[model samples]
Target: MELRQLQYFVKVAKKQHMTQAAEELRVAQSAVSRQIRHLEEELGVRLFVQKGRNLQLTPAGSLFLSRAEHILTDLERAVGEVREFLDPEAGEIRVGFPHSVSVSILPAFISCFKKEHPNVKFRLKQGTYTSLIRDVTEGEIDLAIISPCPETHELVKGEVMLTEELLAVLPPNHALAGCKSIRLEQLKEEPFVMFGEQYSLRPIVMNACLKAGFVPKIEFEGDETDTIRGLVAAGMGVSLLPELALRYSTHIEPCVVKVDPKVTRTVGIIRRRDEKLPPVTELFGRFLMEFQPSADPGRPMDRLDGA
Candidate 1:
């Protein structure tokens, strides 16, 4: 089948509405429908089945959709690489960052990179570590900044950008609030305010607690760090949070204590392992790893290691 047919099918599959897909593609609804039908005929399998007003992908359609999306993404990347090779400085890079990184180095990294490569445009996505890795694996984003580098497929490569200390957060009036440092086991009985299960921090904290010999009693689970910190400040629970999160907060009700064993989260850059990145993306990735935010020069920035 032609590339155009695959493109139309992917759009329709994503939107699940012929008219919506057509509008997104800037083509007529009839044309989209006809091309999708032709694609199905060419594949000798039904790709979509109508369910009320929405178009649903059949089992065969679901399988084909994944392949079609990968093909389209690869084609786009190939074209981008060629264009960027010719003009080196003029290409878009899709970069993803988890909430913690976004609050810390993201602003400085972007501002510094922009001053250096003014023509390079960035499309940024803020997501959880899990979502960032999924997007990178699916080719939806070129690179991501994530914490506690993940176990990835052979196709993914990563390098440590920096490591940040994970501190225990509690209400200012808590018994241990005045302490300079606390061990993981000491907070075993404390009710924890934690990010949702999808966040990479949750697993890190849980594993640390498990090693310390107790499962944490989670009193609240939320999506945002600031919200969770607020809960802690209100005495709802205690939490383990990255030190960078404190830098962005104006609220002073929560007291942060260094962990005795000094828990740390390693933040890193992840990209496709074997694929050559576009010029702008490659340059941006390097810039990010080397960027030392002057505001926190005391924190250690790690060197890049092969994924």
Candidate 2:
């Protein structure tokens, strides 16, 4: 019901031992237990169920724990925002990047941003683009660098960062190895090794194939681009990967074929549409959209979703 109660609940939920939580909070065990009991009675739902000396959350308790953590996190963020509003240059911004973006232009972007905002520390979180969007929308991250905008809710899209193509990475000895360009139709029959359904790339790859008139026969799936490329080189199956996905490899010798000018990816910034822009977040978003010297800008993407 209160901030202090939520803090105690979080500490106890983490330790699953009231005595330990009280020790960590530097309070009497009875005081911690009393507050927890008061919270449970007020909500008319138990937050944790005890089993002898050990502790664990019931199904209801588990769900409540997640909500409690979020409530506490939101409060902390609200306080931090107020404090930062008073002293703009002194707070940390938690930024999340797609796994793909971290390898590409992010290094330069981070270096450049740090030079300008040395007092501002960045806490980096990495995940796929879909997850990044969800985190940013939920106030988990101040800004997210992700692939092209889709029909997402409560997100503000910034300038396009870079346009990229979906390249087919084929093994050196594959039949299409020497080909400079391969159409989506040509790859319709090839076995594909792709990221799982959770990745944004999977939807794009599947849509491309469905447009080409065949369903992709996904033979293997992985979360990492390098792993997928390695699978390709080992003669497992070919993969559709973006430029950012290919940044960390030297071992796999795969021929990357541009899926033509029709199929490309665009990177952009995503922030919560509901939230007022803090100066740091707004500045970082623009800094992210700036062109990098080595960015291999791809062809125009006006017709990317066309069949």
Candidate 3:
């Protein structure tokens, strides 16, 4: 089928109305209808059926839509790669990151990279740890900045940048809040606020508590680090968060104490091992490997300070 036919088919599938699809594509309604009919004929399957005023895809149609969309995305990326090769400084990079680093680490790297390559554009996606890794493996994102970076994955490769400490965060009025360092077992009786199961940090916190000899009693679960911190500050419960996540906490400051055992997570960049990155993505990946934050938040004396 022609490229235009695929384009028209996708547009029609999305709009589900021949007239609206035509309007968006800036083409005659008859032209859109003709193309859809031709596409269906060529594929030897009925793609759409009328549901009152709107059209809906049949099972075959739904399957074809997914493949068609993938083809279109691949074509777009292929074209972008050609243009990027010609002018590496003026291309787009799609990067994924987890919520734990959204406030500090991701911004720091992006700001530093942009200072030298101001014209390079970035599309950043913040997701759960599992989703970020899956996105990289599936080619949804060119790179991902992940914590507790995996050592062995069949589909992706990781480059560990640095290991950062995970500290105990408590409500300011808690008795242990004033201590420099406390054993994990010391807070065993305290109710815990934790990240959801999807986050990589949750298991780390769970395992640390398990190692400390008790299963934590989770009182509240949050998806965002800020939300968990807020819950802790509001006296909801105590939590364990990465040092980077607490670096810029401004509102309702939670007391950040060092865990005596000193739990840490490795921060790293991950990309698909099989795919060759575009010029701009390659450059950014190289920069990340060489870049270091001005101060290591994981240091023992680094207190949680609001920005």
Q: Report lDDT (CA) for all predictions.
A: 0.85, 0.76, 0.89
Cα lDDT tens digits for candidate 2, 111-137: 767777888778899988778877877
What TM-scores do the predictions have?
A: 0.84, 0.79, 0.90
Q: In model 1, where is the ten-residue run with the lowest total lDDT?
A: 298-307
What is the descending lDDT order?
3, 1, 2
lDDT of 1 by residue, 116-216 (tens): 78998889999887788888887889999988775556767889877778899989899999999888899998999999988889988898888888999
List, residue by residue over 1-307, the lDDT tens digit for candidate 3: 9999999999999999999999999999999999999999999999999999999999999999999998998998899999999999999999999887787777777876898899999999888778898998777899999988989999999999778889999999999999999999998999999998888999999999999999999999998988999999999999999887787847689999999898988999999987889999999998877755547553312212312
lDDT of 3 at 250: 74
Query: What would the TM-score be for candidate 2 when compared with the true structure?
Result: 0.79
Candidate 2, overall lDDT?
0.76
**Model 1 ranges off by over 4 Å:** 12-23, 29-64, 293-307
Best by TM-score: 3
Q: Rank the candidates by TM-score, best first.
A: 3, 1, 2
lDDT, model 3: 0.89
Go through the candidates in order and give the C-alpha RMSD of each one to the true structure. 4.0, 5.7, 4.0
